[model samples]
Structures are given as C-alpha cells and as structure tokens.
Target: MWISTSFFMMLHIPLRTETTSLMSSGKTLRKGVRKMKREILYPELTTLYGDGGNMLLLKQCCNDAVFRETGLEEVPWFVSEDVDFICIGSMSEPKQLLVREKLKPYKERIRELIEKGTVFLVTGNAMELFGQYIEDRKERMEMLGIFDYHAQRNLDKRLNYIVLAQYEKLPVVGVKSQFSQIHGLDNHHFLKMVKGLGDNEGSEFEGIHYRNFFGTYCLGPLLVYNPQFTKHLLELCGQKGEIVFEKELEEAYYERLRKYRHPDSPVVLGHGFI
Candidate 1:
C-alpha cells in the first residue's frame, strides 16, 4: 500500500507517523477506551502561533482519535458532543471578545466539563478566556468566570520572551508574545517559571493547571514538543500504555531545547500568530 507524501508533508507529520491521522470519523484513537472527541476552538481566529500544528500533532499521537474544528461562524461541537480533549490557541483581543459572546450561551456546559475533569490544553492568550474578566484602558470585559484570574491589556506595550518550563518531568519550551498580562489569577500554577516572565514580566509563575486543564504561554505546537505531556494527556484520555511517535517527538523536542539553551544562538520570535 502507498500514500501520498504530500499529504504527510502538508500535516508536517513525520514520515513514519503518517498513518496515525487516518483514523475514521476524523480521529486518532486508541484501543479499549471509550470513543471521544477532540476539538480545536475557533480555528479562524484562535489558529495563531502555529497553534494549528497542535491539532496535527494530536492526530499524530493517536491515529484512532477523532478531531474536530470549531470555526468562527459555527458553534463548537463540544457544546453538543462528548469531548475528551479541547485545544484553544491564541487569538486577537477582539476575536477573544467574540469567542466570549459565542461561548456565553454554553457557559454552564463548559463549567460542567471542567468540573468533570475534561482535558483542555489552552495555549497563549486563549487561556485568558477562562478568567473572570479582561480590562483594558477603554473598558472591562467579563469572561467565563471559571477562574478568579482577570487580564489587563496594555496596547502600548507587548511582552515577548523565550520561556522554558519543566512540568511533570517533561521539558516544555516555547515563545511567549502578548499584550495582556493576567492578574488576580487565583488558580493552580501548573509549571514553574525556570526563566523569563510569568503572568507578567514581574512575576515568576507561568500557567494554569486545574484538574485536567493545562494552560500555558508556551506556544511551539505545545504538545508536539512535549511528548511526555502528550503521553500524560493520552493517559488522561484513557490510553493506558506507551505513547505513539515517542522517539520522533522527543528528538524534535531535544533539538529545539538545545537551540533555545545555547547562549550563542539568536533568541528571536519565530513564527507566532497571536
């Protein structure tokens, strides 16, 4: 049997892991676990920072797992379906407001999923959606109210960093670029800030970790570069064994880590959307 090399190249998947995304019903699945859905929220807007790569990476990790994308004009399938994992990536401040409006109708459902321990990996400013509100110089916008955190946006100044964090024995490295800083963020800090800024440049904490949810500023196709973290999520989704594509993913991770840690290597913002 043969497959198109271009298709694999399009997904940026490794040559050996090309078949992992061919799962029926648009999923990558594991054996014996109850079937579930994984959704990408508002791809049109929240698809920045190579966040779209996160979806492709998830497909690589579990070939039988089904994947869904919620567009800006459409309601998220998770609102109606049983979603096991949700990925919300970066977006602009205006787009973030639009998301809040759309999600407001399903607030209770989201809250219920969070309470029931649904796994969510929210990257970049997308994590801002779960906060109490967002305040800029112009106005204050109310958010999901899922957490005590509130965001303050500074249109005048943008913060960018080469940040690294080790969470649960895994090396998570990525770039952070944003105009808003979270404050009054009252939630569990998932990863320690080994270097660079946290909620803001003055702070040391980096992300939110509540139950099955992991929110972070690190945005290098978050999971693709964190195989251990992805394996943990696979376990949370009921895959009770070794993760697929482990060696390839780990190799890419280490290479990136070495580049980031080397003092002589130029540290600049790579490809990022929001």
Candidate 2:
C-alpha cells in the first residue's frame, strides 16, 4: 500500500504482506540465518534532496529480502563499521560540507571497505563529493577523495529528469539534479544510459562505476522505480537464498514503473532544479 503527500511531494510505501510475514517469521527463527548489516549515513546538517525518500525505500527493500524473505537479521551502522552496503543520499551544498567534516575521521575505513568489494550507492552531491574537491566560490573544501574525479558547481542551470538504465543485468530508474561539472576522472565505466543524464551531458559521464561503487546524479525517489536494482543490491549483500515473490509486491512495483514511465507522470516533472 502507498500514500502520497502533495505538500512535501512524499510517498509513503508500506511493506508488502510477504515481507511483513517473512520478517515476523525470521525474528522467530533468527538462530540459524546469517545476518546482513546495511548502513545509510544521513548528514543531519545537510538539506536533503530527492524527495528524501531513498532511505525509506532502501529500508523496505532490505526488510523484504534479508529480514522478510530469508529470515536473516539485519542491522544499521552509522558511525563506521563493517557495513555490507553504504548509501549516501543528496543534500544541499552547505549541508554537504558539514557532512564532509563529520566523515573526515572515517575516510580510511571507508576506503578499506570499498576495496573489499563493499557496495557504495552515492547519489547526487554525495557522489560528487567522493571526488577531489567542491568549489562554491565563497568556500572551497576537500571531499573524501574516494573516486578519481573533481566537481565544480555551476550556477547556470540545474539538470533534472528521470533516468533509465541497466547495470549488472538489473534495470534502474532515478532522477538527476545538480549544477556541478565532474572532471579529472581517469578510469571508470558506465553501466547504461537511457533517458536523463546519459554518460556525460547526455553523451558521456552519465553514471560512474569503480569496483562495487555506483554513483549517479539521479534522484526521483530512485529506488521506487528500480526494484530490480534493489534486488541485485540485496543479493550482493548476501541474501541470495531461494525465495518466492508475492504477487502483491510484484504488482505494486510494476505499477510504479509504469506510472513513472509515462511521459506526463507528475513525478517525472522538474522540481525547479532544471
């Protein structure tokens, strides 16, 4: 089930029956299953972008797979630990700087984890900051320097739209909005390009991939349009056990995809960022 709020443009998505049942059953049988821990680090100081819906989507996805389907326990680690997957969402420039300061201590640890093949899903400015630096004219700050790139903010225009692609056999959908131009990237590969922000300037640099890290500028409540990507992510997190998909879940997900794919869908419109 899902509900929408016009004021915040937020959508409330409920856990499917199979997911709820699995989580309930898994809690009862926690003794035998291997657990997976995923972390979502939100910088409180940063102004959230992308409808602020990605975390909810991620939680629901993980709950369905690890907690609901396979009955595997899951945990959230924010301060830095052995995280199987780490997601960094979009935030405003000032807020991003604050987060950069907060994350300074964990830079080495984050690098280590990524080298071990841990998945990192960095969206919006989060992806931009992983590069060398971000210059806002008034202030210039260094980022985590995880990826081999640089981001320079542009006040001229903001790009916003829905994105379509396939990565590692999983279909994905997302929205893009940023004024930053990325450069200094030496080696990287793109998974796919469909509608919005393809490679770079709709030509190249659409998406970036290095090892297990996936970075994109897409925002449009990304996960809601890309359940297949979520499934693959969970599989990478070690929840590949056999399971049956409930009809309700499938129906809900596909319906969302259809709606978003429409040329005139409300969610597909620009939110003043373009």
Model 1 misplaced regions, further than 4 Å: 1-33, 240-245, 262-274
Worst 10 residues of 1 by lDDT: 13-22
Q: Best candidate, TM-score-wise? A: 1
Reference-based TM-score, model 2: 0.73
Cα lDDT of model 2 by residue, 100-166, tens digit: 7767777877778878888877777788767888776666678888777777676677656666656
Positional deviation of residue 207's Cα in model 1 after best superposition, in angstroms: 1.1
Task: Give the C-alpha lDDT of model 1.
Answer: 0.74
Q: When superposed on Cα atoms, how far off is each prediction in RMSD? A: 5.3, 6.5
- Tell me the deviation in Å of residue 255 in model 1: 2.6
The C-alpha local distance difference test score for the whole of candidate 2 amounts to 0.59
